[model samples]
Target: MRFSSTVAFPLAANLLPPLASAIRISPAPNGALLLRDSYDYIVVGAGIGGLVVANRLTEDPSVSVLVIEAGDLDDRGEDVSIPGSVGFEDPRRYEVKLTMTEQEFLDNKTRTVSQGKAVGGGTIVNGLVWTRGSTANFDAWERLGNPGWGWSGLLPYFRKSETYSTRDHDISACKIPVPVHPVNGKHGDQGPVEVGYPNYYYNQSDNFLDGVQQLGIPVNEDPNSGNATGATVVPSSMTQKNQSRSDARTAYLDPALGRDNLHLVTNHTVTHILHNSSGNAIASRDTPIVNVTGVEFASNVTGTMMNVTCDKEVILAAGAILSPVLLQISGIGPAQHLKDLGVNVAVDLPGVGSNFQDHPTLQPVYKYTAPDVFSVQDIVGATRDAVREEYLANRTGPWTTPMVNAVAFPALSWVTDNFRELLDEAVNTTSNLPSSYDSTLRAGYAAQKNETLCFLSRTDTPTYELMSTSWGQLAVSAMQPFSRGTVLARSSSIFDNTQPIVDPRYCSNSIDCKLLLLGIKFNDHLIATSPMAALMPVPPPGFGTADARNETSLDETMRAMITTGFHFSGTTSMLPQNLGGVVDPSLRVYGTANLRVVDAGVIPLLPGAHTQATVYAIAEKAADIIKAGSSDAFPGAKS
Candidate 1:
């Protein structure tokens, strides 16, 4: 049955001792506090995943959940709550930047990879796009042996965690729609999470959608229905009337914050997962013992190390990059890599830090000769002051805008069936399969064979995969990318000067490069289309004839301008241990039982849309599995 409201489990009171004595809670030590000396569940990194898991698990009174957030909660006024304040260039919402160095990807020079280290994780400082991948994509995962990961299996959780706010008349007047799936009974009605259309929109947004439609792309009513193959104006995680942005903290934490069983510790960093010498049976054991529990954290202000312990499980929700690094530091990654840095290997799971993937985006901006829609600069000065006054007075203004007002999915023709056949043949012929080919590869090969032989009827066409085509002078990104990358820690020490290496290997695969280039070309084609061209009389800056020429080769230009889509996945990938996967289908690391990863890091492959909604779904499903004794909840026979 449905456990949405009837599940009235109380949190374990014995787990939380006071913040004063349980652990040291001091701001002088970077304003970090030890709210609980021991908890049944110690979730590391207060990102979307951690917050969801903690919030869900705490519903049970018997389970004491402690969420240690490295960064402080949003105290910078209501600027973060504003709707129009979203964009890559917006600096008011994001203050603390957790920087990483990626030398292998960007011109082989160290580049800073910044992520929000605060309460809501990237949700507080992200595009706030609410989209999901294609059902076909998830079906492919199940076909590859991950049984429960299929779209059908996961759709329930997606609906359960969502509370769609679609009744606002202003949104309808703006032409923004919330398309719901026919079989959406599983969705919550009065849930705390708010999902709705943003109130404000650029006039060009409508023109942009019409332009793409004229260029042969169909308009989709609901992009989140698992078939993201058309252009449409998708919704965001925001309030309907006020138009204020709703972050993960607002959706998951704020409603449940008053629960005494749920304890939140800010300014605390989790260094590693503590394990006992039970050796390797740790994962399967029902009662795993902790030798001596402790967490390694530093002051957000001064960057100093602090150690704290947990009475039970240490859950790692440190996103795709930091999660794997934390595992390696805890001696759970490649045995050879850990030995090189003088750290004792706890678990010899070679896949702990392998199978990394990310969506690399290239935006070819078009300069609008006409006074384009309101630009970020337009809202500054007196406009900014007025918006600030409005926000302070009523919590509404341009400051509440999400990064992108609209998003659409378009398919690229290059990475179609023919391309897959060629890649499959090449992979089969290559004797050296990088020693990383495990179940995922075998499953991919098997799926390829079936596709080639039967010519399966699938909605997601490689020739036209999912691309986030939208209005404005820009397109969000292509939903699914064939390119694969990796995230590696430079040293075992959590405090190592070296940054965690992230090589997106963007456009490294010819198919991915072609898809990106095609997407850019298609976007340009849409702008030139009759219906849209009439409205968008002028294009945004960076779109010109010289750049759009057929002979110009948009591939080169895309490679030069492409940036990380920020949808990082597959680092601590979920696959069979033998297949170079760190976590199993249940999301528990192969060699460790008491420890588990509940974040984007375990995503076997990138979803076809934005990761925020998918991440929330993953966390919701993970909580269910964890609550249902872990064995009978997920794919594969439970360990």
Candidate 2:
């Protein structure tokens, strides 16, 4: 079946109601204008975190907030708004290219790391999963010296940004059966963001859930509930009836367009945060005075430089990958690395770009007996036409299906236990530090020691702290890895075409590798299980073996297939200044008083679920913290 590539449709050109008056952009005199000449707050990157922060902070009419985005806003064109038409939309049409770097990972040379460079950031390009970190995961944060970050503390904000679709009770019941805990707060009825199950569903999803259950995994009606350790059909971060993608723009920017206090600038690349030399005392301190004087950026649209001063604060919400790079570019990373790139160090915070983490995933494809599963051929043929017909006529069909509608979470007890033991042994072996060593040898030793220690420390850590199991395998990840990686400057000149260093340093720790191995094994087991058995061609050909345990030798092949789960986190981590953290609990950067990082980068640790809901909750709580002069009310605030 071939789908039609062209279909005429009506568009609501006036979807966005005009504000009191449209703010026209005057051409730059010669270069772009800096924040010093513009607004009170400047938010860099328009991802979920940035949008939320920008939306909330701009609520005060007295304070004008400027959001500089690297990408263009969604056109709400047919391809972007129609379900299943995502592929038809040119990926480049929605992309704003950031520079790329040639880096090695797991022996693979030259990997390109791309980030969403457009108005909505990654939210526009992502799969739109709406999972939140577990309650246990949040509570663990409080235990880890960051108070007020637990599930109870963050529930209000979760509810605040969500307007869940109450329409499709039947579909919602089957997909997400778990009832919301009243104590956790109800879904926000008046929130700007919309959350609900996709407007359509495929039969295979239900069968997939049943297959995992047959393999001894329990079926979880709600993956968002604190416990995400079983097979479940989860909800997408999308609106219901219209099937329009619920990106950051749809959720935050659309509603905020008419607000007088909010200003969004597209095609602007923030270069650095301007500091006030007059306030040397605050500037020298670890907790930098939050008083950010200005921000400098390059106007991508005009090829000119600009500076904008902030009267209140400068917030960096550039996602896990770019946020750290932005900091390094601004001279806030390790002094040595900054000097190597010939960039002056504004702050000597070693942890500024450290602790990079993401849920690395691998796709093990199977040939199902059923004919309905989508493939590249189906996307181009008659099947596509039928699906498109149904979609345009009734708003139902394959267009509504996410890449994976149902997911399984399996606990591999054996792998978990072995990993714990291995980590413990490694830790015990490296307990005492050496007094001295050759510089070269010392560097090698330091790298090895860091990896081993992170693994060991992570294993012994409580389940809530880690999330997921230490088992032999788990198909799904709720694993909160403790290993830290770094992001540094690759070059001094942005115009010189230098790519920012993005070392996810994935599985640098042996324990992380082991956990990922277990995850694959679990995936194999679930596929082999009876209920799901019909969907599989055993061994999954190249990716797996008949004997899951013996297939451990295929670790290299598995790693090659692994890509990010889109859960990038922990860069610009929030810890006390003395502990090498960039931000305090108040989400304020060290040595900068009025500047704060209110996004996932401020997340000190990875949570056990998708970051969307948690990011929202964090923004909600941050709004309150920023509103109240005292930071003590929030988690991770310094005493």
Candidate 3:
């Protein structure tokens, strides 16, 4: 049942024409030749989701898969391949900066949201911490109309995505009650993505987990099995032999690249999904779903417009922001918005770009006055040079691990005293919107609010992620935020560098601010604990002081610390269309046939843990649905 191997299925590719798949990187209009005139599937955006889906769909020789990546294939240089070079490299090489200016909230401050723009997507530039959310986090997906999307349903695919390596974790090194949890499901024997521990983690990482235990919060040893609610030593998506980052580049795309049935075009921006109601295999005959014909793209550098057709489907894996932007510009969005852009509306679907959700993070820096354990704070000058030399010579050392090692997930009851009070306000976050808010969106939020209430009432739910990263910083992101934002196209020209109006609307809801303030409160308690106080001796300036840091002072620090966690989702939600969802349980867009979204965008709710692991699983399951030829593979998907 596992299909991660690169060996294509032995089937006749009679439907696919002869292709010159050996395409060298070239300038346009010559680059258009890299793409065949037609393909069975044209996948937009080569992010983690796109890469996984493309790899699986092409396993059948009868299918021709074309992956159009807006960013070029990574050089696989140490800057990207090494785990420690995360913040050191120029991000523009791997990420796109979607600038948001003068927000309606957060005192009218501006922020820039960055997403993976390369062939491997964010996995190339992201923190290599490998973790999954609670079982309840995914079970909520099933409750939200997606049946086969719960924890039990997706665990097999989660197992199908990685090969985990055993580690002799030094329990003595960790001055804690529990050392390690048993790996549940005993999964990970056959997958391309490598999941293992770093050889050169900071000595204080174990102590951080010990501090959480001292705080009365249970440390979850292996939440990857199911429930995730405590602090644990986070593993990395790193190679077992070299300890280099094992991202979408090294894992899925590279091994599958040599196959003749698969073709990938880089540095081309997909502008629109071309359609005229002609070809669609999965469009329901009873509905008014329009047939998706092809995609219109342009060279990122030369702006040479080109088009290619697809025989079956046009899959949108362009992440939360651009995927919806592509739909709106392609006339498959809100009728009024499309009319404003002077584009004819393909589908009058109003939920194309609404319900934008993200893990809004607030990072407050604390000076490590404790005996210089040589963490990210002191990775400079001679130490940096010495580590670089050791890594280059021996291929192991401080360079093998990113600054983010162990993260603590705490429930609201453990972090704050006003759990009941906060839960009441949290449940109403998505309700009672202004007149401008769509009625269907309001209904969707109402349903989502019920899920939020469910998470808050449970002891297994970790409402906040207390993470310590580089430069003596304590960052916290609300595991499940209630605020809803938008990603509307300013104009119908994303291919020409028209930045979509990107706004997560951080702190638009009152509960979101409360969650962040509670995080600040938790940081104060964390550093005060005996074990953590030894590692992070100093807290942020005068802050983290119970009485010294009141509402106004903490609010000021929060305003300065708040930033997007980069785990964006819910723009193309997978809920019933009546509930203001863009995609159904089948992941197909509301009014478009053969146009499915398989990125974090379709995840209606943000999981309590990092999105990296869950996104891979999403793509894995998505490939199954596509291979089964629609929702027929999924029970109860007939809805």
Of candidate 2, the 10-residue stretch with the lowest lDDT total is 464-473
Clashes of each: 33, 50, 0
Best by lDDT: 3
Off by over 4 Å in 1: 1-36, 88-111, 170-173, 177-186, 278-294, 298-307, 371-376, 386-400, 413-457, 460-472, 535-543, 550-553, 634-639
Q: Write the per-residue lDDT of candidate 2 for residues 281-342, one digit (tens) a residue.
A: 32234445335677877865346667788777788887776777777666666666677777
Angstrom error of the Cα, residue 86, model 1: value is 0.8
User: Model 3, range 1-639, lDDT digits (tens) per residue?
Assistant: 000112111212321222223532355464445557799999998888898999888888888988888787766666677777766656656677778756566767777766777878988878888888888999999998888888878888888898887455552232322455557563576787998766666766666677777888887777566767887767778876667788886677777746788888887788888988532222232374687899988776367778899999999998888888888888877778888898777777777788888888876777676665667546677887788777767667777777687778888898877899888777655443434457888888888878988887787878888776544667788888878788788888885435788877777777888888878877777778887777755766547586444788768667666778878888888888777888887788876767889898898888888888999988888888888886647622110
Question: What CA RMSD would candidate 2 show?
Answer: 6.2
What is candidate 1's local distance difference test score?
A: 0.61
- Locate the minimum summed-lDDT window of 10 residues in model 1: 1-10
Ranking by lDDT: 3, 1, 2
RMSD per candidate (Å) reads 7.8, 6.2, 7.0
Candidate 3 global lDDT: 0.75
TM-scores for the candidates = 0.82, 0.82, 0.91
Residues 82-154, model 1: lDDT tens digits: 5454543334334344343442333443333557767788887676677776787667656655668888778
Q: Name the candidate, 1 or 3, with the larger TM-score value.
A: 3
